[model samples]
Target: MNIDIKADDSPVTRADREVEAHLREMIAATYPDHGIIGEEHGSTGADREYVWILDPIDGTKAFITGRPLFGTLIGLLRDGRPILGVIDHPALNERWIGGLDYPTRFCGAPARTRVCATVENAILAATAPEMFVGKPAFEGLRQRVKLPVWGGDCFNYGLVASGHLDLAVEAGMAIYDYLPLVPVITAAGGVITDWRGQALGLDSGDEVLAAGDPALHQAAVAILKG
Candidate 1:
């Protein structure tokens, strides 16, 4: 589908809208009482007991630039808490899924994050440095992690969940942008939280930090807090 600009100046494409619509339609047909929230479309029954979150294209800019790192994010929230998630990179033929009771799976096999006890040796990533424009917390992280990469979008979180990347820090994220990563990373033995080390939810703020090791996560949180 062709590309277009949203009111917020972010890129969008017909594919995003069409895929979200199709997913919403299928969810509604299968679970008529369930709620649905999507980036392309607004929410329906969001206050219900169960809600499905969808981001048909998680990295529209990457997709527009012909980068296969963009992904489709699908998350299930129970009472405003994420319980299930899926990050699918169709172009890369990679997919990761997880849930409260379901083990994280990458390309149909069980997945787990690695143990990197220190940020100095951790492989770090974020969607872009610009995402941290006014957030000093990110700078604190920037000075700590080794070999920080500039781009990955949701793909980095998938890598973290698959034991490939050690950490991912993102700022200025919407609920849909970070929700899917929660289940994926947490289920993979990683930790994801806000800069304050608080749990994330539908009403969480923009800043997010994820780490493969709990010790590394706490270290980053301490740095952000300091």
Candidate 2:
């Protein structure tokens, strides 16, 4: 399987399509009643109560470049709220999975957030600095924030959910890019939402922020809302 990157710089690869195909086939065979919405392919079986949202390769550019920042995102939504999420970074040999009954873990051990307050002391990540689109609010927020250690696609959110980063923010991401992350971060004792602090769900439009602690999240939101 081979995938072609679009003119917009969004990437595609064999792994991306293959992973989604495999997952779709498995879901169809095991849970024939459920629905699926994927990045590469579109939607199927919409009438069911359960929907599997997939971004087979969250960072296809990184994957193609061998950067190890790419990942396979799988989210199971029940009644429009994600109940199970799996982020697999095969190149990094790391996979984070969480659900109603499953514990949040890095590898096999439980993971928890560290108390990091004040933007100055916090580590941050974002997909692109230009994505803010000349919004002074976001510019002001960036200035006030602490050191931005690294940036990537959904990998940043994965780091925040795993307690390795304090926050991850992005200006214009689709539901597929944000929905799978909501449950993963929240289940790990973190907070996730749009710039206004509104709860992130399947239907949330674009913008997003994921933080490991509530106070950090509130502070970040205040900056973004400014």
Off by over 4 Å in 1: none
**TM-score for each candidate, following the candidate numbering:** 0.97, 0.92
Whole-model lDDT, model 1: 0.91
Candidate 2: misplaced stretches above 4 Å?
1-3, 7-9
Give the per-residue lDDT of model 1 (tens digit) for 1-226.
5888988789899888999999998999999999998998999999999999999999999888899999999999999999999999999999999989898999999999999999899988988878888788778778877878889899999899988899899988888999888999999999999989999998899999999999999999999888
Q: Taking the tens digit of each residue's C-alpha lDDT, what string does model 2 give over 81-149?
A: 888888778888987877776767778778666677676677888877778776677766667766775
lDDT (Cα atoms) of all candidates against the true structure? 0.91, 0.81
| Reference-based TM-score, model 2 | 0.92
Best candidate per TM-score, number? 1
Ten contiguous residues with the weakest lDDT in model 1? 136-145
Measured by lDDT, the strongest candidate is 1
